[model samples]
Target: MRLELLYFFFYSMTVYILETNGWPQQGKHELRWNHSYTGINKPSNPIDKEVLEEFYHSTAGPAWLNNAHWLSGDPCESKWYGVGCNPSGDVVELDLSNNLLAGELPDRLSNMKNLEVLILRHNAISGTISPLLFTMKALRVIDLSYNKLSGSFPPQIELPFLTNLSLSNNQLEGYLPNHWNCLNLEVISISSNMLQGVLPNGLSTLSSLKYFDVSENFFIGPFPKEYSSLTSLETMWLFTNRFNNSIIPESWNKLVKMKNFQADSLAGNLPELIGVNWSDLEVLIVVDGHLTGDIPESFCHLKKLKYLHLFRNSLSGPLPKCFCDLPTSSLVSINLSYNQITGTVPDCFDNFRDLRYFYMENNNLTGTLPRSLSACKHLYTIDVSNNYLVGSIPSLYANLKDTLNWFELDNNRLNEIEDGLEDFIVTLSTKFCSLYGNPWSCPLPNYFSGKEYCTARCSSCNTLEQHSSCEKCLTSTSNCGWCADGRNCLEGYTNGPYYPYHCDQSEWVFGNKTNC
Candidate 1:
C-alpha cells in the first residue's frame, strides 16, 4: 500500500510538470510574466502590467514617451508616470493629459477594470471612443477633450459613476447619445464639436449636473423643457448654436442656483422678471439676438450680477429704472449696443461703482453725459455714440486721464467741448476719444480737428494712425502747418531735438492761452 501511494503521487507530480512545461510551446519568456508577485509598494499586478504595456506600445511611441516603467517593471514599485494604484496594487487612475500623445486610444484599455479616472485631454488622439470604456462602472472622470477624435458616439452609452465628462474641441460628430441617465454627473462640456441634432432632454435628468456647456455645436433646439428641473445647475452655455425656438423664461424657474447663462443668437424676449427665480445669477450674456422689450426691473434683484451683455438686440425702452435702487448690486460691465433702446441715458452710474465697461452705442438714447459717470473711478471704457445726446461733455472724470482708455461720444448733437476739459483732451491718446460727427465750428480745436468725422469743421484725417492729411491753419502763419502731438507746428518741427513738443496746443487755443 505504501509503494502504490508513492507511485501514484509521483505520477501526479510528473503530469503537473509536463502540463506547465507544455505551455512554453506557446512562448518561452511570455509565460514567465504570469508569475504572481507580492510586496509593499510593489508594481501593479501582472494583469494591469500587461494591459499598460499594450497601451504604451499601441499608442504612438513619441521620443518623449519615457514611461518604460509601465512596460516590464512593476508600475507601483517603479512609480510609473501618470499611473495611480490602490493599496492592493491595482491600477485605479491613468492621467496622461497634455502629453502630446498622438494616437488613437487602444482597444485593450478596458483591461484595467479597476480604473476610476482616465484623463487624456489636450492630446492628438484620434478615433471613436471605445464603448468598452463606458461599461467601466468605476470610471468617475473621463476627460478626452482637445483631441482629434472623430466618429459618431455610440448610442445608449452608460457610465453610471461618471462625474465629469469633458469631450470638448474634438471632431466628434452625430447626435448626442440618448437615454443617458448619469445621476452623479456634475459637468458635461461637449462644446466646440460637430454634435448635431436637438439637445436631448435626458441631459436635464442629471440631478447632480452643475455645469452643462454645449456651445459652438450644430444643436437645433427648442431648448429642452426639462432643463428647468436642473436645480443643481450653476452655469449653462448654449451659445453659437442654431436653435429654432426662443427661450421660455418659465422653463428655467427652478434654476435658482444658476450663476452664468449665455445664449448668443437665441431668439427671445426679455422676460419681465427673469431675476425673480435666477436671483443668484451673476453673468447673463444674450448678445446678437432678436430679443425685444424694456430692460427688466427685476434685474435689480440679482445682487451678485457682474456682467450684463444684451448687445445687438431689438430691446427698446429706457434702462431699467430700479437698477439704481439696488443696494447690493455689483455691476461691472454692461453692454447694450446696437439696440433700438429709446429714452435718455439713465444716471445709474452711482450704483455701478465697480463699472469698467459701459457700452450703449448705436441706440436712440438722448441725454447729456451723466455727471454720475464722472464719479466711477473704475470706469475705463464708455461708448454712447450714435445717439441724440445734447450738452457739453463732462468737465472731467475721476480717472479719465489714466484709466479711461476708450471714450466714444461721436454722432451726437453736442455743441461744444467743456472749456476746462481741453487740457484733458490734449493729454488723451488720439482716437481713444472720438468727438466728431457733431456741429463743432470750423477751425476746431487742434486736438479734436484731426478726426475724419470732424471734417465738416476742419481738414480731418480719416485714418486713426499717421494723420498726415490733417494740416492746420496756424495762428502765427496763414500757411497751413502740420499737427503733431496735438499741436500745429512748422514742417521742420520734427527736426528739433524735442520734436513733438508739448505745446499744450488745445489749452493754448481754447484755454485763453496764446501759444497756438
Candidate 2:
C-alpha cells in the first residue's frame, strides 16, 4: 500500500506538470519563457491595460472560457486560450473565434505593441470600430466577422501592413470609408449589411484585391464603371441585392479571370455581352432579374458553364435546344420556369444524362412528352405544368422509376398515361406523379384513396369516359339490335356512365347522344 501511494503521488505530479507550461518530463527540466519584447516590467499604460483586459475578458478572451486562470501563478507559462505570446511574454496572436464574447472593444488591445494577428469572429462584440486603434501599424490581419458589431466605419485610418479583412455578417451600415485604399488587401467580404450609396470609385486601384463580395444590401443606382480596372479580380458576388442598374459598359467581357458569376436579381436583360472568351465561366445565374427576350443561341459559346439558372423572367421563344448539349460532367440544376417559353421540349435534352433537376413549366410547349425522356439516365424531377402538351405518357420509367421523384404536369392535356405511370406515382405517393387537366378515360389507382376522381377532369368536362364490354362487340358471341331511327341510343361500351341504354335529346353531346 505504501508503494502504491508513492506511485500515485508521482503520477499526479507528472500529470499536473504536463498540463501546465514547461519542458519535457525526461527526468524533470523546467522550460523557460523567452520575451521577444524590448523591455521588462515597464509601467502599465492605462489605455493599453484596458484594451488588454477587455480582450482577456471578451468572448475572444480566456477568462470566461474554462474559467481557469490561464495567466495564474506566472506569465511565462504555456500558450493561453485564444492567445499566443512571444518568448518575452508579449501577446502576438489572439484568436478568440466562436466564443460568446459580449461587449465593446477594450482600448488596451492597441497596447500589445508586438501583436500581429487578432481574430474575434463569431462573437457578440458590439460598438463602433475604434479609429485610434490603427496606430499599431504592425498589425497584419483582422477578422471580426459574424458578430453583432454595429455603426459606420471611420475614415482616414490606414493600416499599411493589413492584408486580410473580413467584417461580413455584421450590422455595419453607412457608406464605406474612402481614401483608405488598402492596396495590399487580398480578401474583403462586407456581405449581409445595410450599406448603401454608390461603391467608392478608385477601388480598382487596389490591384492586389482578389475576393470582393458586397452582396445582400440596399445599394442602388448605376453599376460602378471603375470596377473594370480590376484586372486581377477573380470571384465577384453581387447576388440578392437592389443593385438595380444595368450590367455596366459592354466591355464587361474584360473580366477574364472571373469564375462564379451570380447577378441573379441584377436588373436588365443579358446583353450580347455573351459569346466572348469567358472561358472560366462556371456558374452564370442571371436569373430572377428583369431579363427579357429569348436566350441567345450564342449561349452555346460558353463551354464551361456548369450551372445556369435563367428562370423567373419575361424570357420568350423556344428554349435554346442546345442548352443541355454541353459536356454532361458538371451540370447541376436548370430552372427556366414562369416565363413565356414555347415550342416542343428539345430532343437535345437526351444528352443531359447527368441532369438532376430540369424545370421548364408554365410554357406553350405543345405535342406529347418526348419518348427520349426515358434516355435521361440521371434525371430526378421534371416540371412541365401549364403547357399545351397532349397525348398519353409513355411507359418511360425503367430508368427513372427507382430514382425519379416529382413528375408534375398539372395543366397539360394528359389523361390515359400508361398503367406504369399510375402505379409508379401511386407507389411513390409523396415523391412522384400528378395529372390535373387532361380529359380521357383514366381510372384512379387503388393507392389514391378518399377521392374518387381528379376534380380537374370530372367538374369541367362534364363527361365520365370508361371502357366496358358492349352488347355487340366485333368478336363477342352476342347479337345486338341497332334500331337506327327514332328514340335510339348511340353505340358505346357495355360498361359506360350508364348500365341500361337511354337517350335524352336535351343534354345530347359527344359521339352522337351516347347512352350508358
**Candidate with the greatest TM-score versus the true structure:** 1
Give the per-residue lDDT digits (tens) of candidate 1, residues 142-225: 888888988777786577888888888888889987688588998888888898998887776788998888888899868777
Model 2 TM-score, 2 decimals: 0.73
Predicted candidate 2, C-alpha RMSD: 16.0
Rate residue 75 of model 1 by lDDT.
Answer: 82
lDDT (Cα atoms) of all candidates against the true structure: 0.67, 0.58
Error of 2 at 190 (Å): 1.0
